[model samples]
Target: MWLDKESQIDLLAYSPFAELITNITANERLNPLTIGLFGRWGAGKSTLLKLVEKNIEERDETKKKFVCISLNSWVFEGYDDAKSAIMESLLRTLMDNQPAFEELKDEIRSLIGRINFMKLGATAIKHGMPLVMSAINPATATLTMAQYFSKTKRKEILNDIKQVWNEKEIEEDRDTTVENIRLFRKEFSDLIDKSEIDNLIVMIDDLDRCTPERVIETLEAVKLFLSVPKTTFIIAVDNQVMKYSIENKYPKITEGSEDFSDSYIEKIIQLPISIPELSETDIKNYLLLLICELYLSKGVPSIKANQLDILLSKVKEDNIFVNGIKIDLEFVKSAFEQYDYTILDKGEIDEFEKMFDIIGKTSDVIASILKGNPRQAKRFLNSFLIRKSLAEIYYKTDRTFDYAILAKLMALEYIDMNRFKELYKWAIENQKNSKIKELETITNISRNDEELPEEYRKWSDEKLARWLKSDPIDLHEKDLLKYFYLTRESLDINVSVSDSLGKAELMVFNKILQSKRATEYSLLIEKLKENKDIKYTKILDALIEEFKKNSKLLKKMQPLYICYSEYRSEIKDVLKKMKITEINLQTATALCSMYQADKPGFSDVIKSWTDKGLAQDVLDVIIQEK
Candidate 1:
């Protein structure tokens, strides 16, 4: 069963093109009107046109009289060919709306026949005229015809055709080609008008894909052929491609000219529709729900509300300043699960973190691949998930939940293993800071490092580090690691480190302290706050004293403080409350006393007082006296 992944759905909802279609379709005027569906490639122009077509098809009988025809000009080569193709398409479309145009079908066919005959005659004359014309004038121009036409009785046929053309009225009409084409178009328009088809909606899709000449030709044909009342032509195209096509075809037409491609199309088309981008929240929620659905299908337990809350909390915590748009991962994940696929535990928690890290690190790379197109983003994520499943199968392990695996998956298109390893090394080396900022900076490092002078590189690194440590904070160690891995893999190193490790670490520590077991951490923080000089000091001294008093407690707490000095400020509030102040000094004193009991001095006295938790305050008073 094919599940609906986030990529499959309409992530960018409620497009404005729908309104333009409604207004055009609702109007009863018989005059021809044009609407241009404009945007960059993959901007959902084709999707919008298809949507409008579907909507119109679903309408009741009262609205059924409206004939909608969709065509693409790229199927033909050059302007003349595309124009003929369009004319043929119009004929077929008119026939399809048999209920409305049945009465005028014969007349329409006749007009088509006349145009076809004219084209055939023109081809034959061009090919067979040379020999017969040479008899009339020694230096007559040679004639050439397309291979599709038969070459028989060349001289006799040319003579007969010339004699027919030389007749009084035909000879008098010097503008035969132009006049015939115009007359044929008029007849076709008249037939449509008399048929009273209510409305004629011709939608041209993928005009951008057409050659420049063909695109202009198609546009011009629409302007000429559909110049009747109650007719509307909607074209789906990339504005840039259209502009380029026009400039290429008409080099003399300068940029910003009133006769620019879009402006010319706009003169015929009343509405120019532009699809809006999907908000980040919408995108996240959509993906989350899709993942949730996938998980459920894999027999994973339904994500509980609290679990979803936790997920959302993580998302919010990680993305604190995402345009003031607040969303929890659980909400996003659960919605995705229920609506599309579920995020089944295919791997361990660590593996999942790694995957998330990859995604976080290479967000810009992924964003670039998607071309800022939401549909592409959905496709990429869905594809990544599928690849992860395949990898799980191949490895014969449940590493799908392993964050590293996910990171690998997220970095599939962004970064290679070598680059990912470098990012990993960078993150590990800078573990003293919060994970978010580190990962973010690493992922978004400048790709143009070579372009940067040595001085600029140093300046940039310093500036980035300072910026990463700023407020309205963004830095998260895990986030930074993931972003670094993903972005580095994708080779997009232009991302800035928006927050610092200290801030993110503090936030996490604060949250942990705010939980049920708050006493120890809170007390440690308060003590540290009371002693200004105790900042960023190792907690070893305090831990050793506690060990002397109660070895069990010391053993229980040593691991927490082992690397505390490296991340002291980050976890200062938590450490201070735990009464773990002056750890470095206390450790130094304890070591000195152990080595020099016989050589007693202030260091010995200080060591003894600190072990008893009395030296810090006493020393403060003593230092003041000195």
Candidate 2:
């Protein structure tokens, strides 16, 4: 299995994009630039960031040098406010790295003192303190400590801050919080200028993971404090996630008027460099390289490290007319020739070429399902290898199982797990070559049919049909016990860890299950507003188990919780699957009471309750509410 980390090598042929960004960033004319490196999560945004940094570092021939720095913005998310966190981190980095600024250590230390004071003044209330800094603005330094803290303690905290300016020497007019903020920016900028560093390049990563507040705060800090001359900030974040963050922080925009988030990010990010989703060709080449590299790592005599590059160069060019990498026999022959299999005789070479063909054919399906994501491609490849490894060891009697068949079945399992299980069930009950009659129409048919089985009808989807028509399409002749044997552990493991909720989720989940009073669910209500889908599923799963474990305690609030969730559409599906025997008129009344409109719009949900043994009269009353 390969480690899921950023790589220095450009395996996805993403070097051209990385190099373009490096050129744009390295041009000193673009100093004071804020470049937003936008991509979906796991689209190699982080790896591309590394490539850009490496490119900049390699520019020793350029007369000017860069003082490159990296800040993982999410690291500061939970520990403290984003603005101050970034500010202090900058001070520490500059102070620690630049020995030329050794003489200014005292000044930098003084800067830290002032930042701490401002941070405490700005965020004292957010940490549950009653101190009102908003009223007596931190910019003005007129802090109000009397409401909560003891007067003596307040004085001690204030008096402990280093005296940056003497009261006797300076007028009272200059001691304002706003003045200090202006002074901090000037002083920090001065420190960078004085250090004699030609330029400062700070790349911020993982801002996508921050809360909306932190996301907006860090961006504000970058725009406000760090956009100085001779400085460039490359922030790697998902554009959509950033839009969500901006919308969350400043959500007062009138609908259809304009998207405030678009304007907001555009202003701060001078140049937004978006990394598009990997194309089908890019993903195919990526998978090809990954498989070859895996084999190379295993000391495969057929291929060498440099030859992998030769293969990459040829496939990435994709001159199919001249027989380069494509989904057919020609590409397989080309790969084997590039592999330089002189040690192998004609038979071994033929066998190895067949092995190469499996990667080619399977990758086409994998690429489509992976949605052109390099990280997803890597992960799928890893999982496929793990299953292959386990299949070899688990069924030692069937070590010669055709890998093409394993790849085909695993692709189905990876894509539609439920369908995979159904197929497995079909395969397990019979001998080799037993036909799955359901596939007769679903794979061959181009459109949906009312008479087709519900599960099989969904298989008529274009992508699934494409997968079904791939080589080894009819598994009727194959004994798939070997396939099921590998997925046995995987199937069990998926069930075991399916509902691994985070700490915040689990905490609120426990309270939801244990609480006797409806008033005690403020946290549950809050959590529902955020990440509600997963939270709803977890609650539903937990309630199912709770019903099995203790029917008495589970009956009170689980249905109420599910109904109170404003996600009426999703709750309808969850309720359909659930057996909430306690979903009576009182529970219905409680749920409807919170609905704003006369039409509460869960007619089907209430109608389905009669089948779960709801009283006919009670069902009539609930249905009337709709």
Candidate 3:
């Protein structure tokens, strides 16, 4: 039900940690500070950083001098030189920011020119000089660029470097690397000094998610080139990852006196903050709120009329035992109570009460199995929602599942998958009627049963016993096939529904189907570029489905192709494999709109259009441009 992304709201009470960070960074006395926000993966580091931005903005509402730039270093890994990439990304973000930046256009342009020259110097060193210097003419000096930027400026930089090469002193140009770095630093500090801004906060997030080479390169860039006055870098990473990346980068930097990597970190990170793991109570409350939010979006108007701001703090009400854990239903009521009318006269109460118990009872099992990870908890909830929807889709009726039984079964599966599979096999093989008679005995029998077989002794585990003893008991009497139907992945399940997609993919698919504006499509294309591993066919099929059904949505699909060129190869390959002859004009017109002179794979589509008896001179006009 919940997408595994950073929460825009302070659900985990991350604002205090953010407040501490903002308190430190807001002071110009602490300028040039590199504060390390250390945490485990998915421990809300990104969310906490977002809250830090909020805190800074709130604190600076009167003056408005803080410029916050959020950058993910993992995006640059294996794609470009990390050092210049970070600088370039910072410049691009600055140009995009609208406040006092509009006045510094001249300084910004000069900075970009300096970076462009340094980029060319690094390229010449890494790729042999002759590749550029030997063929050092205006045409050949159009050096390769690592980014798709202003082509005119790219050519200008090329000419500058080409001019440097034509001076006939290659050795002098080689020394420009060190000289250029010193000049870049001086110019950067000068620019910051001349700006109207007081604090320039750059949040370098997901640094630990990058490869070791990128990790070293990015850190080196920050430490070596860009540590200027009135600037602060909030670096988020796992402690061990930073240490390990250092070890990988400098295996023998010292002669063994306590590791130079530690000293390196101690020097760069002036303040270290570690975000601790979630407690079981936090995990239970998070799942409960997610359930309420998920169900609220689906016809529960009372729950929506009220807000879910209860997650901002720990519930302090007296707790009663729901199954085995403490659940505060009174607090749940406070969240839903508006004008003193109880929710749906008891149906909503039962749903909320039941889910509180469902999440409350099995939280210990999940906390032990998954270490109470917030990301894993959200994933499990998403899995439960998908299976519930699949049950409805497979039955082709409005009758939904008994959410309690399905949830309990999924808890068992999450805690002990092997046990669940063995239970399923036993129901089919031993009971002979899709009934697990042994489940009744195993779930009920004592641990001291001397007559019990050794193979089934694991069912006596404490967590397993508690899970089975929870509500929705006696699975031995029900048809196991119906319960296992939606859980089975090998079934002929329909993937066109949201049930089959990940939380993010489903959201993207729905957006693709419904968005009618080119502006919205532009934003969607940017999101798609950020998430590269998303299945192209999921989007392609969504577009094709809409175009076939309504034919008006084709207008929405064309702009996405014209603008986003990063995934064009994958889109073309999918189209080539598809049978688009049935929708000839719809397919051919879109393909022709996307035609590029350098990019191939459109000939077949052109021939298909001709096969459909379209005009020949239309193709000729396109070919003439090529």
Q: What is each predicted model's overall lDDT from 0 to 1? A: 0.49, 0.64, 0.64
lDDT minimum window of 10 residues, candidate 2: 164-173
Model 1 ranges with Cα > 4 A deviation:
1-9, 61-63, 77-80, 102-104, 117-174, 253-263, 277-371, 398-626
CA lDDT, candidate 1, residue 472: 16
The positional error of residue 525 in candidate 3, measured at the CA in angstroms, is 53
Model 2 CA lDDT for position 598:
21
Candidate 2 runs further than 4 Å off: 61-64, 95-114, 117-177, 253-259, 297-305, 309-338, 341-355, 431-433, 440-455, 489-626
Return the candidate ranking by TM-score, descending: 2, 3, 1
Q: Write the per-residue lDDT of candidate 3 for residues 160-189, one digit (tens) a residue.
A: 565643432323223333444567789888
lDDT of 2 at 346: 32
Give a tens-digit lDDT track for model 2, residues 154-241: 4544443234332223223233333445666787788777777667788899888889888887887787667887788899998989
Please report how far candidate 3 places residue 573 from its true position, in Å.
Answer: 52
TM-score, candidate 2, is 0.66
Using TM-score, give the best candidate's number. Answer: 2
Of candidates 2 and 1, the better by TM-score: 2
Model 3: what TM-score?
0.64
